[model samples]
Target: MMVDEPPASARFVVIGGGVHGLSAAWHLAKELTASGENPNVIVLEKSQIGAGASGISGGIVRNFYRSEAMTEVIAESVAIFEDDREGFGFHQVGYLAVVPEVQREDLEAIAEHQCEVGYESELASGDSNCREYLEWLWPDVNSEGVQAVLHEKRSGWADAIGTIRNLARHAREAGVRIFEGVEVIGLGYSGAEVSEVITSGGAIGCEAVIAAPGLWAPAWWQMQGLDPLVTIGEGDSAEQRPLTEYWLAREGDYLLPGVGLAGNAGRAAPVVHFDHTAPLYSDRDGELITDQPWGIYFRMGMTGGSVVGGGLPLEMGPDFELDPYGPENPKQLAGDDLSEFFTSGLAFALKRFRGASDLWDSNPNGGVLALTPDRYPVADWTAPNVYSILDAGHGFKMLAVGREAAREILGSAKSSLLAPFRLSRFGSGATHVVSKSPYPWT
Candidate 1:
């Protein structure tokens, strides 16, 4: 169905219609509607909803943070995922993070802290599941070395497309208008404030403008004479890049259906295979191989008894030019890089776990995605009347910024929820990045 355009006297004009953009429009529309004003909120998307990262994510939702601020804000988001069922379809399948035999003690200490704060995690042993994986899992613990899997029963994945679409639908029901397939050319700034947004469609006047362009933020920044650090490269490279060189990915975690009795009472649990690289991460620009033994696995998603695991974070290759604004090239871009990365993980899984990486098959990156600096996320106010939200490397789970961003755009008085990610942190001489575990799980 074709969308209808609004007259020049629109209430609010939003550019970019991803999770964050739609979230803002949804909340803001209701805010205006409640004030007895039939505010005409228009959201302009160059593509379809979730055409970028929001639609094609791994769909995991966990605050999993070493910082209190992140935890507190995400607490509000987690509540929406778990409690707001009619609004979105959320699944509590559970999450499992295995501790290597060598770093078992350190990881365990961190796990203890996480549990004390809000994580329901525990240490895993081989007997957690009497399966062949148990042989490789939790290989052996040397020293006070780590050899356990931290399990979080409350955290899990969700329906990415469903939630965003639901938000869009709710916004429309509340009298917000949407315009997809419309490209934003630039902004009409007067006295440092955006008066109107210039797009492929035409001029759209509004009381205020908010930009939640997500992966394509570089475009808007470039129009404003600001250059983003992320560069866009080709996804079709021929060079055989080492998996460990650019993306420190390994295949230790596979969704094994029926491993063992992985739960207590009604709670969900599964045996994790440690010892191996199911929990590989970036450390000193290489894979952290473990020699110790013993770990835990988990069986979540009651019906499917599914399993999940993560390796180390992917280090931006020296060749990786962080250009999020370059033209769409086909020679050697992240798409091919991800293709190779996923292929490598699958092949490694075949040899290591005797299975495959299901992310591709499940359309994990089903939406457009991008990586941010510090590899966490950016959720802060930029110029006046303009705010931003980017989850760096952890955008999926960190999408709590969706509602938070919405609240900010609506000018809600209680947007104190977003003080943590204020863009000023970059220039305030504030080294507030959480103490990262030697494990690059970001």
Candidate 2:
């Protein structure tokens, strides 16, 4: 429900109405209800729910990160998504990553760690085996320079908007009052802690504040009088970098009217991700697109057709506007060059995608990602009473963040899963291990 005005005060004030914010509110309310305490939680949304990045996310849920810490967090999130497949709009068709020999070692190591954590996945190595594995799912596979394949049987995608709506419903049902069009301007501090959330509607006194502002996080960080820049490394190698950098990802779908993942029989196919070093050639013209390494991911769209996307992201300045986000912003749309690159890359990977250039539909999805220094996420308490969920573009999939965050906010000990992504990691040089893949968030 969209409340016209927020209460004069709330016990717990959550900023932002995207996946992170709503998830936090829902989980917090659940915890409060379980403890027989009043769930005086209020969610303030500048726009409406799912109006930001969460609305247009690819919704790809996978635990294929090179970082063990991220993998663990994602694994836990996958379990949550699995528990409520219908409510979360999860497909559970699974996720497949096809990579070249250059990433074989890292892929194997990640697979090993995933196994150690009891996450189910399969690894197929060597060009022949990899091709065979891909053929099992996609018979038209034409991957070149591919040497290994990692398939996560439990990972898949969800409906981005639907998930957020469901989350809002759950939160409201748990006694969390959500007020849309209620923009939070700033936070009022009492000594070192945030005493109230100053909003356009009115000031709402609160005991604690959870900031999950998504793309507007940089602005929130500044409003709180915190530095937006930080040191990325330690000692001699340490270098200062902006804590938030924006990148516009090119994403779209192919309108193959009557086709889906043909090789997978009638069952839905897993999300297919390709990271190859092979030269990409246009299926329509045989002209070489690029000989350099590239990455792309695609899967069956919910309504129909194939959703395909992937290319080098276009970097934006720190002061980029956040008002018109996603495809709604013309500047965020995939250009001709990127559209051609992504479509051609898709054609290069699958025979079914041949001539998909003309069928490209770029309006469905595309958005700017607010990335951290290491392109991961930061979920920690920035102040004594302010908990920030800065996901750096990995929000929708990591639903477990809210559950764990709710526990911590209620005075539980620091979460081991979230400790790895603390803001202090930047100064301590405890950043995640960079991957060999071209994609920043591998």
Candidate 3:
């Protein structure tokens, strides 16, 4: 969040305009009002809402994950997504994962895990509704020799822009003031804590602050006396071309049965949709898809899109400095980079679900922004009034609860809910690198 002009004073200041920041604002307002502590809650955005990677996210929500910490916390966010109708748009669609022969075991294992967590999921025969969902949606799904599929009824996609817009709107109604196009420059600390944030417009006094800079956070943290290994995806590469062929994913991404249609029956009985795979864009240059805000490539986005198009891969992207209230240097993406990504993705889809690749395009969607080092979100409470949720594999699925975590800093009902994920995990070396590839790991 950026403010062109500063407020004389505020009890709380939530930075960044992305989902996490917005969630913090919304939760802050709700919690504060409930406590009769009408603190001057402010949210500042340097650009328009969702300007960073939030708007472009391929909103996928699932409880089938490996990390206990992540799963537990995200479950709360999912509750927010599903429970609250006015502020978020999360409709329950079944995620029918058409299992490729090789990944059958892993998919089954994930299903069992989902059951342990109270998710109504099961393994289905190839001839069941899973197959029909595929056939219905991608009518031409090359089901030749396709294996059994796993179905989880809880997960599905959401309208990213709508979710954030709703959060901002509701936060406003709750009495939080949001200032777009305002650039936040530096942090002004008093004694040992943050006293105020300096913006291009002036200075805003605050008792607490939340720095949710997404991929730009490394630079932001650097500005605030920290260093994180941050880098942007090689937007796109030159040699690896986007090919419109088909190949079966062995131990790779999820295979959707299709939503609403036959490939998937809108039963809300299985998984909502198929997870996306990493596309091979080149033989030489290698750039990883950073786990940033924009990396939530549900299914089609990766398929019909290019791979190495001089832009960030999925939720991955380049590192940039941000003066929340100033001109942010946005990254540019383009070319065969996109074509190759789409080509590989479609090719994989063609192999997995039998002709599902045909549902996408031969080129990747260009003009999307992202932030990185997002495999898991980062959060730490340095003191009583400040905390940051920086690392997230795909933050959107957990935004609701992530905001709840932020609310703890500003005096929410249960701050203990966030204690498990505090920065102390990293300090104690309890933080570990996690990968939630639907199934079939690389």
Candidate 4:
């Protein structure tokens, strides 16, 4: 509900109504009510729910990661999405990662870890095996330079806005009050802890605060007098880097009616991601697109009759403004070149999309992301009583982060899963390992 005035006080105040905030609120309300405590949880949103990056997300849910910690966390999240498949609008069409020879070792290690964690997946090693596996799914798959494949049968995509709405419904039913258009202006601090949340409408005293501001995290971090820059590494080799970097991505789909782009078994096609060093050529003019490493992920559109996907993102400067933060905002949208490259890349990967370059949708679908230094998420207590769910660019798929965060907020033991994402990692030089893949978050 859109309330004009917030309560004078609440047990907990959650900022941002996206996936992380709402998920935390929903879980918190359930736990608090079950424990005979007052479920006085309030969720404050600057705009409406699902108005941030969550609304514009590609909604791909996969546990394919080079890091074991990330794989475990995302596996749990995928389970949560599967548990409420209908409610979350999740389509268990599976997830596939096709990579070059250089990533074979990392992909094998990930597959082994997934087995140890009881996550179901199949790994196809070598160029021949990879090509055969991909051919069995889609005969027209262009697996020229592919040397490895990791296919997770349980992972797939979900409807972003639908999932957010369902989460809001759950939170509301559990006695969580959600207010829209109530922007969090600042935080009132008493000594080291936050005493209250000062908003556009009024002030609300709360015991703890969970800030999940998404792309607007830099602004919120600044409001708390926290430095946005951090020192990575140690000793004389140390380097200063922004804690959060802004990135602009272009995502769109091409309408192709009567085109049953399904897998070999007549099932819906799984979400496919291709990372290759093979030079790409334009399907429209046979012109060389690039000889360098590139990656792209695509899936059957939620609305049907369309193929939705996106390519690499363009990084914005440190001074990039995030005031108007939506694809509807002109400045937030990507350029036409991205669309051209994305479509051309799609055709280069699959013969089914041979003429995809001409089927490009005029409407642009893109948004900004606030990425951490290592591209991994930071989900820890940034302040004495404030827990920030800084997801970097991995927010939508990791819905279980909120559930785990709720337990921590309710005075439970710290989660071992979330320990790797602590804010202290950077200062201690314990950042996540980088991958050979072109994608930063891979």
Among these predictions, the greatest TM-score belongs to: 4
lDDT of 2 by residue, 333-403 (tens): 76767667767777778777687566556543478888898888889998988899996877789888888
- Angstrom error at residue 132, model 1: 17
- lDDT (10s digit) by residue, model 4, range 48-157: 99998898898999988887889889889988888889999999999999999888888999899999998999999998999899999888888898999999989999
Ranking by TM-score: 4, 2, 3, 1
C-alpha-based local distance difference test score of model 1: 0.53
Predict model 2's lDDT versus the native: 0.84
For all candidates, the clash counts are 44, 0, 73, 0
- For each candidate in turn, the TM-score is 0.69, 0.96, 0.70, 0.96
Candidate 1, residues 1-442, lDDT tens digits: the string is 6566645647677777777777777777777778886767888888777676566444666545555566566666667666666566676755555444444454455566556667555545442332232333323212122345556556766666787887688778878788888887977877887777788878877677767776555556676665454322233432222111123222222333443224333343332223343533222233543432322222232245333433333454524433332224222123333433333332332233223334332211112235443344566666676666654544555445766776666666546667756554444433234533443432
Q: What is the C-alpha RMSD of each candidate to the true structure, in Å?
A: 8.7, 1.8, 9.4, 1.6
The per-residue C-alpha lDDT of model 1 at residue 135 equals 31
The lDDT of model 3 is: 0.54
Worst 10 residues of 2 by lDDT: 356-365
Better of 1 and 2 by lDDT: 2
